[model samples]
Target: MTELFDADPQAAIAAYGTEAISDPLDMLSRLTAAAAHTMEAMGKRVNDIEAIRYENKQGGEQIRGEVKLYMQAMAQTGKFLDMLIKSGFEERKIKLDEQTAGMFVTAMQRVCARLELTPEQTVLVGTVVPEVLRGLEA
Candidate 1:
């Protein structure tokens, strides 16, 4: 492990470029942009899901199926987000992988608890989380 030091660190940092920082500002900017896009997509998906749920909430087989799909999608999205954070930390040599993952998981759990979702919305979120993660990793 490279020991952290203060004196004349520019040479050492230049050796690793931007990746050496705890949180590269440029990387964070890109991640933030991707996250914004994901949030927009998620909003649209939620709207569609709400429409479907409203249209077919008569306690039928389809409703059960949709609910199951929705839950699965949500879980998958959560996992992808975890992957994103993991990759980001790995790339940056951040030491708090566990803490970062926990923060993301906790945030997702809180969001899920607050929002009622449908299958479409869940799937969309799943897709978006991975995309955002990829952006961050890059």
Candidate 2:
């Protein structure tokens, strides 16, 4: 995973092109791509936390607490990204389609699995994603 850092607006705008900004589908594609990248990055972070525990046995308890905090942060961030993507579609008057939702759910599921979410966490995601998607569809 690329090192997490602040994105340069000029670089993004230039990479996306001025013409793409006016296109809602193109915008959605960009948002989806970003969401996927975040998920992958979160998974890598979770793996990194595990590696840290193995490398620093003296700080196992503190590392575990940090791991829990990281998991919660990632979960919330994932949900926010999900909502942001849905809102982007709704704001653009684009109907949420099965393929788009499926791809998003799959990506999120992978992240949740990587983070080893609790049953309640899993259920919250299972419930919320569909509700948001359904609202977008309606």
Candidate 3:
């Protein structure tokens, strides 16, 4: 790729104490990918918990048992997301932009699918944005 020299000087000064954002767009891309990777690593952890659910359940009770565990995780995720949003908005004066909102939609979809949650379990997990859910499911 060509060298990207165009960096917002103001942002660099604020965030990095530099004259310009050294890598600019490349830094954003790297950070985005790193965040995605971290989430993936965290996702694998749910499997370990679900495996315990699987072991403790009778064959026919597999769905019910795992759904319970799944719901607990989902509820915690929702609470954490809510807290993060509040913290960002209140403490940092950061509002959720459309791009971040769309990202949250995708993340909700991915987590739901990863847990293989049912409709009832979905309700227990909360966060039912009609348009976002519909679009994700579609």
Candidate lDDT (C-alpha), each: 0.62, 0.66, 0.57
Candidate 3 regions off by >4 Å? 1-18, 21-96, 127-138
Q: Per-residue CA lDDT of candidate 1, range 16-64, in tens?
A: 6764556554455456556555555655565566444433456543444
Best by TM-score: 1
Q: What is the lDDT of residue 72 in candidate 1?
A: 54
lDDT (C-alpha) at residue 67 in model 1: 54
Best by lDDT: 2
In model 1, residue pairs whose N, Cα or C atoms come closer than 3 Å (at least 3 residues apart or on different chains), thus clashing, are none
Please write out the lDDT profile of model 3 over residues 1-138, one tens digit for every residue.
112224555654556544666844344445545555555555566565635433334545344444554555556555555555554433432344666877987897789889999999887666556655688987
Residue-level lDDT tens digits of model 2 in 1-138: 122223565666566566635665665566656656666676667776645354355654344544665566667667656766776755554454666767887899899999999999999988887798789988
lDDT of 1 at 65: 42
Question: The CA-based lDDT of model 2 is what?
Answer: 0.66
How far off is model 3, as Cα RMSD?
21.3
RMSD of candidate 1 to the truth, in angstroms, is 25.3
Colliding residue pairs in candidate 3: none
Residue 34, model 2: lDDT of 63
